[model samples]
Target: MAPAAAAAAQPAPPSLSLPPSQFARLQPHAYLLAHLSPPPSSNQPSIRANGRAPSQFRVTSANTGSLTHTNGSAVVRLGDTTAVCGVRAEILHTEDIASWSVSRPTPASSSPTGNKRRKLTDSTAKLSAESENKEEDGDDESQIQDFSLLVPNLSLSTGCAPGFIPGAPPSALAQSLSHQILTLLHSTRLVRAEDLRIWYQPPNLGPEELERHNENEQMDVDAPQGEVDLEKNKEIKAFWVLYIDIMIISLAGNPFDAAWAAVLAALRDTKLARAWWDVDNEMVVCSDAVSEARKLSLRGLPISSTFCVFEADAASGWRAVVIPDAEEEKELDDSTRKGIQRRWVLADPDGYEEGLSQERICVVVDKEQDGKGKTVIMKLEKNGGWAVDTKELKTLVDISAQRWEDLKQILEQC
Candidate 1:
């Protein structure tokens, strides 16, 4: 036989020597396709690459009080995603509180009775002003925590992910996530407002006398100091402001859930340094004693659950079977089956799964019931192209409630 004829008769051997780097690059795509595609036998359910059920979440772990300088700190890991949160408290005066409150002008309304004589009292006008301010704030309505501020900031660094760059100004994604976190904290009212209030005590002497005494104390180190009267300054005039910072240590998708979890853990562990006004020194003093510090009054623990929505592929045998015309059905091959248009919800999607998902929903729920004794949905955020129905949203809420209990137990352990 001729060499060419012999080579043609023998089939080409399989290519089994692909380079590791090339395989690594193609592995994700291949894996995704495999999961989306149905099994040859048509008896298996379409499973995640990690073998988890569609609605199942990845393993989660949390640790608190990790940073020494921060008043409270926590690190949360959900699968490969990692978020660290730190909370620092500061003192805010009455003027500072007023500045944080939005300023707005009140509108004059026409009298119901034409030319009716009506006099507006000072209290009524003040109430009207506050109502106008609240209206102007709209969805970004600020919560008055004894007029204290709670600022939450999120940072995504280059080390966290491949796309992020170091030294870059805050990205749009970071800003949006920070805003959402702040909104959730405020709306949930997790930290009690009254807990932030710092009462003011009047100085033993008048303002002028107190100034002179302060000067004298500064001038003469050997001079005997007067005892501070803690009971005198009982008027509320200041507050403890909290500054919450969240850092993304790693990016593996579902950052919102991880960040919120870290925030909850950190805030739960926060303790404020004991502060008192020193009438003799004419200044506010914080105690260095750890025993003097007080724990923050946390209202309720709210946990967040996130889900990613992907379009279901009917051709993937896991979906509903399609009925073709009687004649065509018998002749149809596996590849010839067309995919149906449907959506699938995946809970706690990792980076790879998130990449293929189009829509995302984050639900924040608290175990506490409102005055009406119903579970509170602290926050419900949905973004992307797909829409969820009422029934689906209700199911998500139920899932969130379950997650809340699980997370609460974890936090309690921390």
Candidate 2:
């Protein structure tokens, strides 16, 4: 055939045309890379497919006291992901707990201190303080964890995410989220045991009552009514167990952050009424007056920020300029090959970004209200890949610090 005829007979070049949404669903990694690493000749500003910067977080909104029936409730929305948390305070009578007395500290030799039945102050509070001191220090977690005072449960509703069957049991991700929340709760020591304790202070022994008490008491005491053993008389009859329930109404990604934020806001909004053990009724009684209630004094606020690293090769950095260094190309090996790959650190990744990235990092940072108020790292978790190193971790911490400040302001409005 003629040259022109032969050329005409050749097969036509293949071309594909897909809408942006369908392309993202099919080739999420490639789609993201195209936005993040556009060709240099195009002179386009590098941005994520969602029009966000590498470290940009989704819009966040928090609202507390939304559920009037619960003691405390908060609904947090992180972009498309939404989570609601409800904190219910239930009285846990000491009689119900088998190990309640086993862990109780014995009365000290010191003189009995004055007790306040109405307020939180009493000899039992002092004993609790002393008990906390007896610890190695900086570890204020003992009874709260030992007795399981804080109960946190996270549930993902049927429509929250794909593959979450309407009537199926809790998914592994749901279980993992619950574990993470519960772990953070105990690790941070956010709740104070004193806040949960319901104490009972017996009436002081008068001149005649002291003699009668000494005669009936098994242990002989020479001390008179001036300093009766108060620790022995003042007992923790019950505790307020916080049943923190987190429901994921919707999940686009970063469920942990939304869940934790809801937990924090709900706990901050929680208010427990003054409770005491009634000797006549032999049950815990809570005051009806709202003014008598007190908000929980949580520890320093810790905000969690999660980031994922997307690594791409020179060939598919969205087909952008990825010419390897001269030296790298010359000594191309396993190590050098990995070094040539591009990495993009995306913060607050949505469900799409999450599935495309293998390496993940989550930093939990806080600024304590006490003293100079410095930023502290409560937790640093990285897994799935080694793309994130020490320097990357430090950068994540800084990002988390900023996130903490932003969240603090959002929650303050609640």
Candidate 3:
């Protein structure tokens, strides 16, 4: 009896108190879910923990021509993540290339006929491929990748992220980003071959040289119409190589977007100095006058939007009710019984959100001017989870299209 009374008389222990910020850090997924679907009675807005809608992106800013020594430079900031890119132009003389050749390969000979049977076989497709190869040989888009004309390198500073060691070699993430950017540059063909080429016309052509050139042309009379002869009236002299270097000043999240934005901005701002072959000096000479500078004729501006899927683990027992209806509850009874998880799509995710979300999707799009502002998808990449279905993908594309408009405005203003 005395023991029972002592137990009953014990004062009630005080409930533990935890601050919201501390709770947020400890229970990131739960905190985000609460913010995404807030209870109606609380009168809280339906937004992410960072106070952004599911489709809302971070604020963006762009600056160009910041570096004096480089040919062009640009700085881009998306929310807290920032990246700077610098472009340096160098000349590569034609004579310096050891394996350079302008000669077109002759088409393969047909198989020897046996009783006139092989002579009747068709060779149109083979002929077409060989001739197209001959026509687009020298200055096709392949040159950009084959010769490595555009070199892009990305570096993450120690201060940019916590995992980056101070004196360590390039991280796998950095190397992967660099390769992705380079591949995109080549696939987009943003830079024109004509913009990088320098040519010279001889004062006169001798009879022997003219006759030889005429014979070469006569042999290729069956080539495609309107084919651009890379060395039509002038001889190739040199080519400009643009080396793009990107530095991550800060990394909040989505470094790829910021790095690519910086690259695009820098290329648009670039103005290569004019150069010509000096007959007397037998060398390439760059003009000092600013009037001779030329801006790159870039293709349509491509903007990228990234999204992450944040799935709440029902098995972890983290649930906060938000104004549930009886009918809806009954409808989801099977899924609830099955312990199926719920998810949210977060746009322009921050460092905190990135840690919680494993699945990610990035969409690159461009608004075609002549197509009445039609959105053309330049690239699409998604991995890590299967929560994003066709419906979710469509939603992401709409968000990306809107993002393109916003970025286009900022890019032009800069």
Candidate 4:
């Protein structure tokens, strides 16, 4: 064959471009190298894409009462991330409240003889009667059911990010995020349970007494109508239940902080309608009168701040760890003698920054009265294999306190 024909017959060289998966694996490293390294034009390091310092947060804004139909609603934005929270109020029955109590199933008896011998006896009946008496007399001590039920849910759809699918089952990330929000709400005790309680006077007359009273009233034409009606009695029944739903419109990063802020704003704006028991209908009635409505009692405003931890390169005034071969043992010894590896903590990390981070810490803080007045940490969540020092943790908490104050002021304005 001719030389040209032989050359053309040879297999084409492997494509220079990497496969999508391989490129994704290296993208974070590439981003870190480009952003952390000093710029060629200037000796100083390059600024982040949004021109923000490592420790600075993006601009934040909040608005409340945007959804008229909901009991309360709020939209919070931190840079490009946006979250909307809506609170809906509903009536809760006493039986439903009883079911909310945590219960554990008793294990079956392991021994066959014990199971066969188990039977109700006179003593068991006596014990049951005593328990019933205690319940009727309210002698048994138990936790008071003062607070209303709160249910929080989080949604992450395709519009919120690129990877999420539309109309698909909730991903693990969405469920985990919802669980974290609910945990914080309960642990922090931001909403007072007593504020959600609804009280009314139930009727005291039995069926026979009611029938006789109605007949007497009908027969007594000379009696003053208003005076006779004023002698009736009333009783309290149940309370309100709040359903909090949060949606992520855009997820740049640090969703936990944004979602929490939205929740706080919505809850602060919530107002419960007036409710009363109707003896005639045998049901609870809610008044539509706005004048009778009351705002929810908020215990304390808690705010959160998130930080991403990145491994700093040795050139950035920090030691870097690496396994050494026989020939490189001397370099490893020198690095160890110099110092331990150091990490860089970045605040309010965006999506790209989070991709490069190996660890994350979320700190929640609130102002409380503990010896006059003081700032207290409400919750702290750290994820990753990295361990943080005590001093560093303290510093992070202090920063969270400052952020809390700033966010509190913004929420008040909203």
Candidate 5:
């Protein structure tokens, strides 16, 4: 048999499938090698393809408190890549089946068991009393409502990514990124749901009764002016909804960094409206007379950091270029550049690096420690690459700890 014929007869190997984020990590290594091998032009020494010195970072500027009406807003820029985050607080209804409290009042019109109430009084009084109870029920039902933190509905229309189009469904990438940010927030318990519970003096009222009361109040509003049922529209007692919209305005390499930075900036400036519950009146109040806007409590800020690896030589057993400190990055020599790969770790990376990194590792850390004062929550592997040994992993943790402390100090001033 001819060699060509035999080779053609062989079955093709099965293709390997990896997550999209892994694809992003593998993207940079190939292109970065070409740029790294060539000596940087002396004329444009300051401009690296990645747009940062070996030890330097992309220019970072944060403009906070930008939205005039929003509770909080921020816009962050790293070079040409920019992210804007706005936090709008809205009161909504809570559907959580948990937290049913006994002893809470039911509307006089609502049945004791939460069913429809039958008229019991004489015919003439029945009509009068029924109308009155309907009014009362509408006034008292909303004891608590859900609060939502949403990304702008208009953002999708502005063309954030190639996959995103006006009036189109969210692509898989959009869903995944949104999930990531929400998971991170939930894992860290950054926003305490219980904290939102509006405590009332001499408290007591049942959920069923509250709804009935609200129903009655709706009937009383004058035909001309629609009435807002404060009880029915009360802000949720607990839990929060965070909708993150990451606009990939530029598919620059480090979406994680940009997304996280946007998240932090938005959170830093975020605030909520204050609400008070009056136990005596058995109702929630949200008005100028009893309510005021307040900032959300942000304790021990958390930061996510990323690093890019380049120019790897698998045959020679070269692992990666560790940009652990400033000195090493400053002393990058030809041998260092050729023999070892280069890694730029910081809050954000530009388009060049995003397109050409070998592998990327991102670590999230909190500023405060636990009983042992250890703030490191969890180390996540987003884009898969060379498996880091236990020792190297610890080094990553140590670096993250230091970075966390530094950022915490920076936030204090802000």
Candidate 6:
């Protein structure tokens, strides 16, 4: 939501010189300014008659790992804007162990025509059945923990935002943001893999393992069924996954920051179950020994802040105010259509400012492997291209740096 103070500070806009198509894009912005500068209400967060102060922020809260079935999950609230995240895991399996094993040859094996053929076919069929059962058992062992971490399926639903209809499809923007958040966690190896594993056997010895059982059939001939031998086999590690169903319930503004924050809090509050395999009995046993839940070690928290630059006109008059933070604005009453009328940049801007703004830029900053964080600008096109100059880009970077500093201090106190 736009700050009431910025709205009060802005003047009506002047005549537009641009073509109709250009003018159409600015309409949403006019609506945004109106919303931002709406009559100040007591319900507004940190709000005064003027709307906002330079350092004022909306009310913020964290809902850590709200989903019990999931390995991890979180929801974050910034004023009226909110986002939620959930993490799930699955065990992967493969088919194809038949081609490797060789049948044992013996005098009885090479019997006369009819009996020999029947016996050979029956033996082959039995071997195939045994192999299939073994494969299933292995998968069952692996999936136990994976399912325990997160249910086979989860959905992000309407209660997240106001006026949301149940079973409605998520918007494109919401899907994209969810995908990006999940990708980051997966790519960065954020969660520990061992904590999700239920099997004690080595990775190679499990489903993907290739070897033949001996005549006794206690286990594969080459590899013994014994616990010690299984331990020496190969290993496949398990990792965490977030199945996000992001709904832009209110879309008050600054979605990137909201999404990132929600994801972070969810991960921090996630509880992973601790399990182990009992090799001797060929059974997996989970301890009553659950480890204390721990927060994910975040490299650095990156936040994106948006500012809307509005161009006002003769009819509605020239008017511009930053969406949620309008206090830092200048009335562009006399500026030509080509010049920037009013600049509204600080934190989350309401929808109206978002529509009228010439463009929006998001800054993504993160830590390098060495643990040092750096900021990068992500330009959002209002029409189709980047409109920022080098100097303006630098200014955005500086703003992000300061924002991060403020965020770090707040977190330290937490």
Best candidate (score: TM-score):
2
Off by over 4 Å in 3: 1-15, 40-45, 102-139, 204-233, 320-341
- Candidate 1, clashing residue pairs? 200-233, 201-233, 202-233
User: lDDT score, residue 318, model 3?
Assistant: 57
Q: Which stretches of candidate 4 lie over 4 Å from their true place?
A: 1-27, 37-49, 96-148, 202-236, 313-342, 369-373
| Candidate with more favorable, higher TM-score: 2 or 3 | 2
Sorted by TM-score (best first), the order is 2, 3, 1, 4, 5, 6
| Model 2: ten consecutive residues of lowest lDDT | 110-119
| Candidate 5, 171-199: lDDT as tens digits | 66556766677666655555544334554
> Which candidate gets the maximum lDDT versus the true structure?
2
Deviating ranges (above 4 Å) for candidate 1: 1-12, 16-33, 95-148, 201-233, 313-341, 369-374
**Cα lDDT of model 3 by residue, 323-383, tens digit:** 2566765676532423323678899999889999999999998888895888888898999
Better candidate number, 1 or 5, judged by lDDT: 1
Q: Between prediction 1 and prediction 2, which has the larger lDDT?
A: 2
Question: Which is better, 3 or 6, measured by lDDT?
Answer: 3
lDDT of 4 by residue, 71-101 (tens): 9999999999999999999887554655434
lDDT of 4 at 148: 31
TM-score of each: 0.71, 0.83, 0.79, 0.68, 0.57, 0.52
Superposed on all Cα atoms, model 2 deviates from the true structure by an RMSD in Å of 6.7
- Residue 392 accuracy (lDDT) in model 2: 77
Residues 226-269, candidate 2: write the lDDT tens digits: 45445567778888999999999999999999999999999999
Candidate 6 residue-wise lDDT, 1-414, digit = tens: 469888988997886676544544555444444433333332233222125542345666666646777666766676777776665543321112132123111222123431233435677868756775665454433443333322222233466445457878755666666556554444333443344443434444343243333233233233334442443342423323334434344556566577766665655555544444445754444345446434445434554455544434434554333334444334333222123233334345544344445565556544343546555433222332355567876776676677666655543433
